[model samples]
Target: MPVARGTKAQSTKQPRASKAPSVTENVPPQKDEGCQAKRSPSSPQGGPKKRSAFGDITNAHKNQAVTGKKEGVKAPTNKATRAPTAPTVAKNNEINLKKSLKKTPPAEVPVEHEKDSVPEEPVQQVPVVEDIDKEQLGDPYANAEYAKEIFDYMREREDKFLLPDYMEKQPDISRDMRAILVDWMVEVQENFELNHETLYLAVKLVDHYLVEVASMRDKLQLIGSTAVLIASKFEERCPPCVDDFLYICDDAYKREELIAMETSILRTLNFDINIPIPYRFLRRFAKCARASMETLTLARFLCEMTLQEYDYVRERPSKLAASSLLLALIMKNLGGWTPTLEYYSGYCAQDLHPLVKRLNFLLTYQPCDKLKAVRTKYSHRVFFEVAKMTPMDMMKLEEKLKS
Candidate 1:
């Protein structure tokens, strides 16, 4: 090759071929050759590897003989190398970690199952006591059938005297609001331990006043609450304090507002403190019957309960109140109704059966979902004890009062 004048001449002789690279390339080749030698004679390259195998055997024997001559020993056989074992300390730690991960045993199962665990026991079916056997008062029509007379009287009263406008108008007290008031009253009764009659009277007074006086512009709630306050004073020996009432009301009404309302209620009733409450009549009649205190108390409960009934509006508050108390007393296993209970009490006793039957028809013949609030909310003193009264007597009394 040509070179520039300043550059050194290139060597013509090539470096010798390296045995190391050749040995590496031949490594797999050596294994392949060994494998071929082990194959059948039909292979293409089988002859050379077969001769090499015989040569290796001869060379191995020669090497053994040479080793025996030099050191009086034979060559060792080829064997695989073993991997190192884990340290004893590391092995023990790994075992302990596995043991720690294992779960522990649990505690006991309850023997007496909770009510929530199993289906609730079916509500016990209470056996009903028939009114005929349990009651001396007998059926409402036991003495006389008065439903037609009473119903007609009611229709007459509603048509003639109830103020057509008033009858048509749905008052400010919505069903929902009335429910709220009833619940609130029940809470007040429970909290204050007020007499059921007193609470009922308060409720009725509020209702009656609202029906008679309130307009769309008036706040009915204020009237109802105010009425309750007044009735509490009239009915209880130790009347609930105004602060307590305020607390019961959660301070929704101010002290001044309550005083103002009390004044307003007094003015509306024309300051007539003697409102002829049913409790007075109920107590008097119950005493005359020679009934047990339980009976009288029951009767009083029934009488007070009547205040919640829309149908009882036609009945004299006193008569309805008396009959209800009698009913409650009877339910309490007290003395039954007597003619003297009706006649002397001026309750139109002959008509009581029919009136009570009508009430029962209203209460029992259909679902009593509405009255449930009264039963569950109030002490249920009245429902269990009320007596029968005729619808006609109720109508007559209602007519006289409205007129």
Candidate 2:
């Protein structure tokens, strides 16, 4: 046996040498002394110093970097000794990690079933208003694009100007008195060659003024004349002057009285005289029915007749126009209330039947001597003598309504 260098002999006893060489036998004696001096003093002194597992791994990484190849590093075979405070630090870190996880909420993972269970908002559906002026695009005077919107706006404004049999509120006025005034206004419209719209709006102003202010029969003529003066200014491009209105009234009211009455009427009605009238709506609805000149004239006759009747004061202008046009179509043997008419006029035949029957009854009866202006106006050949035409019988009207 050969004694190892840098270590003390156990008993100074020499043993027989084996045929195999010792592990340090190939190394020179001077290299063994240099390696023993370079090792840490804390290593065991029994034999050559042992290298730590960290040193072996570091040396393997260096070898690989130099050789440009990855070395397979093995785990340490011996149990590692940790630092004195390592267990306390690890336990504290674990407890802190648990507390942080408890303080901070977990991420929200959306579940497919839960997502399906949530209710969605309902979508609102809007009512569609039809465009009836498409064919009149070439006619700039027709205002094709804005025609529907314009009529819709007028229909909306009708609610603001609505009357509720306001004659009941007047102490000095009766329905017959109102009818007489309206009849005279019609004659004034014809005599002055004022637009039909001028007549309708003049009547509207009178009724609206009467609704707000109490009036006597003596001042009624003044009110009527002032209304015409205001309406002519509104509807006529070359409206009749104040002198013309004064002349039409047979000088019943002086210039100052008429002018004063005009101010009174305007103030009472809050200066909002852009009233929706049956005449304008009648023309629009007649166009929707594609009514012939005779049919339209007859419808005009029906609408004008209602203007003189105090009973029709509560009717919506649009509804009155629709009902009048429907009756005209029936009398002419034209089709019943059409979808086009319903879409544009906002009334179906059923919706209009009650008023249509009333209008037919109006035409059926002979007018009294006092209220014959509307009948006389329509009886002219120039008006197609629509008043001379027979009214539709009640039974036939019912049959038509059913159809």
Candidate 3:
């Protein structure tokens, strides 16, 4: 009646075919694909995960479905057991990944936005000086290829302004009279607040002219003022007018006389007044010594005092600056000339000894009133009255010199 009942062969084939449907429903389509095909071709190991990122989850569901049938357990029929769509699963995962990336950087790469928020160097909260040992001399011509040539030119031209015959030329003028004129020049320089370089250059120009021309004591002031005028133009930002200088001289010299002397002095010096001075060397030495402000100020006071001595004209500016610095160091109770000073100045203690003695005599002679301008200027509160400081015992200085 059942048309050959239920054929035994047909019954077995039907059950086996039914099992194939259950396996296909549990496993994902992506897992059936070879790992090579599912991975990115551009990646070396096809990267960590690609289309098969959910392969493990898919396999877990597949195993549960297979075990349920073997153990005679009912397969889950809930919506939670619904087959996962590859497109939907990938989309959901992509969203979660994007959110995680925005939270924080998993990689060590620096963020551009973060770098802009931090400063490269810490800000200074207070005014402070650089370390003394780290302080260095300024080199303005450090980049100039012909810097040595320029220096050599300046040095070579210095002899042209030299008063080698200054003693011979000024027969009628005595050294003390020159000292008095220099003292008055110091007063003029201070009153105008001229640059120290200008003062030194003015003195140099005056000495140069003195070697070429003979002027009376009354005319000396006119000549000195004119030299200051020219030097101010060369070195000062806003040099005082010829009239201002004439007024400083108490109108003792007329404007026409000052003008005449300016022209004559320019002619006598051949307009070659761009010479070096001791101030330049002194500053370099002071920096090397790491000299304090007061020590440097005292050294300057001693150096400017040398202008009063006619004998100092013969010594080189470098030696004069070195001796003055050593004397200032000793006078200020600072250390003596250090090895650094000797190397930079090219003068050892033995070389500085005679010059130091000469400077000591000038300090001793300051109170006698022969040359009082420098002492008077430095005695003010602004200078800290370093000029009034007494010299230390000569015996100790001698021991230092010998050592």
lDDT of 3 by residue, 206-240 (tens): 88788778777778778888988999999999999
Full-model lDDT for every candidate: 0.48, 0.73, 0.68
Model 3 scores worst on lDDT over the 10 consecutive residues at 11-20
Q: Write the per-residue lDDT of candidate 1 for residues 48-136, one digit (tens) a residue.
A: 35354334333322212111122222212221111112232123223332332231111111212332335544433432322222333
Question: Model 2 over residues 122-163: C-alpha lDDT tens digits?
Answer: 212323444568888999897898888999999999989889
How do the candidates rank by lDDT, highest first? 2, 3, 1
Candidate 2 TM-score over all chains jointly: 0.67
* Top-down TM-score ranking: 2, 3, 1
Instruction: State every prediction's TM-score relative to the real structure.
Output: 0.47, 0.67, 0.61
The deviation in Å at residue 341 for candidate 3 is: 2.4
Maximum-lDDT candidate: 2
**lDDT, candidate 2, residue 352?**
92
